[model samples]
Target: MSTSPTDSVLEGVLADLAAEGDLLETLVADLPEAGWRTPTPAAGWDVATQIAHLAWTDEAAVAAATDKTTWDALVTELIGTGEQGVDLAALAGGAVAPVDLLSRWRTARTDLAAALRAHPPGAKLSWFGPPMSATSMATARFMETWAHGLDVHAALGVEPEPTDRIRHVAHLGVRTRDFAFAVHGLDRPTEEFRVSLTAPSGDLWAWGPEDAAQTVTGAAYDFCLLVTQRIHRLDTSLVATGRDATTWLGIAQCFAGPPGEGRERR
Candidate 1:
């Protein structure tokens, strides 16, 4: 049997997820007991909290993919507790021991990958924002893993090797341009803006009209970092031309939420 286009996309996303998960695991595997409690770049979150949050989210993703009832209940509980913001989830996970939390994260991530693969490619899964296809959900999981991994790595004072996997995140950032604007009570850009990025392997990846009046041009890794709010826009090499592109860069966010208070410039 030939692989369908959707199958191919899902496979690619799964591969990316595996790579991201491995990176995260390898980065924090050797942390000392003190290191687990060390503060990360995300305010009020420690290394243990970061991994716990990932574990929690992976379990949630599995529920979203495989069991709507459970997923809906989880969402209701989260909302009912008034637990808003990403940090709350991380904080909630802080009680687990480091070893137990790491093990749980590994299992949850594996289960999430399996669950996502089993989901129908075209079916929409519920999320914090609009429903997402399995591919988009997988990609979102990859992005979250990468972003949180960055925080973990930062807390440890280490840098992760950039990979082409960030292309998925960069694409999500571009696609969410209009959504970001809308979430902030601003109108979407009337005209499309060109987005050109140089991938980690020196290959150019792009989106939108090549001749569009507005343009965002930069390294793919930097672009991903910007959209994930892992770095301040001013700290990146990204250059945005035209008013719309510039504005979008300032407010760009890939995750669903109210507008984030992005990182301040170093």
Candidate 2:
């Protein structure tokens, strides 16, 4: 059944969440005990710790859905921590340990998705700060699932083929172009930019104006990896077609927050 973009976005995220969870399960099924302790691509965090953090995030998602006060407080705490001249990188990059965090994360994610699916479309939820519709909340969850899956992909050395659904997520990156510009204190270009992605199903997912002067071209999977900060900008064949396009090429971000350091060509 066809659904509105808002509904579709959440639906897609839920689907992807389920799929990624299955993949993670398979990836860790036969691993050695010490493999869980091995460091992941995320600086300083090992596989076990990453799983634990993912679980914590799932719990946070549930809290946001049911506890507005706690949700608001958590977001405030995060932003305050960021603004207090705290070195986020340093804080995030310390203490890589393996723990039994994955199971909880997996379970929470399942429960959260189920609860969200049952909520009314107009349901109000507290996120980072403002009250967001249930739809926006779903999109946020999708963005995190895709972004974190990147970490798992890196750890497993396996490249997940891009599904047409990725375009659903990638579109978030494209539409958020203005926000990305604002993140760097730059004015958002008044002009539109085009994006084309080749999906795994042998179908094409296209967005923006065909005649847009600025364009991003590449396989859809690569584009997803780039925007999600999974693969390095240089590692992907995705290219920008206009003057400032390249500058914005690798900097696309759909997830929330005060912008992050864009991926660099290492």
Candidate 3:
């Protein structure tokens, strides 16, 4: 059968997810025992906790995609619990051994990718923010894995090689501009802002209206780092040319939840 538009979108997302997953797995594959205990950029979270959090979120994603009852139960439990935030949930993984954490993360991530692929193309899965199609959900998973992977690599004092996969992250960042504003209790920008980035392959990746007065131009990797809250806006090479764009760069966040404490410029 010929591929549908939704299938094509999901296929691309799944490929990105695989690339991101492999990058993280390779980075942590040979980590020393002490390295697992090393504190990452995320306050109080060690490398082990980072991987465990990925595993936990991956498992949650699978449930959200495949089983509404299970996903709803999880949502209810999280809501009922007074301390159901990202940091708190991630830190809970500190109790797991490093070996077990890695194993669990590997299994859950693999399962998550499979579950996403199996989900109907047009069906929406409930998420922390809003319902999303399988393609968008996979993209979110890739973004999270990449962001956490950066934290792990940073703690180990290693820089991950840049890849075109970051295009997915950059796209998500631009798409979430409104959601970021809403999360911060601010009004969304009335006008569209152009976002243009130079990808690792030296191709131009862009979004929003081409002739929009507001624009953000920069390296794709830096843009991804900015949106993921891995680096502060002032620290990157990104140039925001309008008030809205500038303000967006200051508080851009790809993940769901309250604003995060971004990294300080070195």
Candidate 4:
């Protein structure tokens, strides 16, 4: 991978996600017989279900990328099968063992990453909601993987740091900050805010105008966790300074479409 600004950030994210996936694989594979049955934060779903869901989603993403027949067909399948609060629930409800599901998931991520590297950056691709560049779609998938990894992190009581690339995923969330607010029927802020991430490498990832009206300061992992709604803002000492800063913190979204409810507590 080239070490240009964009490629560097993206590669960093890929490496971080890969490491997290390795941890996830080990955790699921080592689970006691009863561990697979332990309930995850996701409603009515256990660890097995979560792993299955990851496998299913990852495969669908890869299908959208490489298979001509699977282009829009898979998106239709997902929307048709999924219901509110359980988007992957219906797809993952199977008899497969947690280990099997995770193994498949590992393969899918590996394949997807390879596909992304092979395709040209500007290649158009089919995603769930909108058409996107291959690179953009890859970034979205990366965010999804990281977000779900946070769930496992929560369950395992481990705090995983983003080595450096979390800034890519975090930038995605920053881009959608307005969309997230609008999803909640709230007005997008007129004022811009600066977001600075102190990555585990001690390198800084900064977004927004340097002299913006508001600022959010924290470790990159905490910011990623907050924007993804994996961790409640109250759970960390992430600082959102300025009046508009608090407002932006209230709604930060990375995904497309209507904004999600996000976390209730600030």
Best by TM-score: 1
TM-scores for every predicted model: 0.96, 0.81, 0.95, 0.82
Q: List the residue pairs that clash in candidate 1.
A: none
lDDT of 1 by residue, 85-107 (tens): 45677786877777888889989
Q: Rate the local accuracy (lDDT) of all candidates.
A: 0.89, 0.68, 0.87, 0.69
Q: Could you arrange the candidates by lDDT from highest to lowest? A: 1, 3, 4, 2
Look at candidate 3 and give me any clashing residue pairs.
none
* Candidate 1 ranges beyond 4 A from true positions: 82-86
Give a tens-digit lDDT track for model 2, residues 1-266. Answer: 86777777678667876776676666765666687766777765666655655566666678877777876776777777763322342234223333334456667778788768776778787665356665566666666666666676677777755556566567767777787787778878878888877776867777888999988887877777776677677888787888767878656677666656655566
Off-target runs (Cα >4 Å) in candidate 4 are: 1-13, 81-94, 158-162, 256-266
Off by over 4 Å in 2: 1-9, 83-99, 129-131, 159-161, 262-266
Model 3 scores a TM of 0.95
Error (Å) of candidate 4 at residue 255 is 3.3
**lDDT of candidate 3 over 17-47, digit per residue (tens):** 8888988888887877888889998888899
Q: Give the TM-score of candidate 1.
A: 0.96
Better of 1 and 2 by lDDT: 1
Candidate closer to the true structure by TM-score (higher is better), 2 or 3: 3
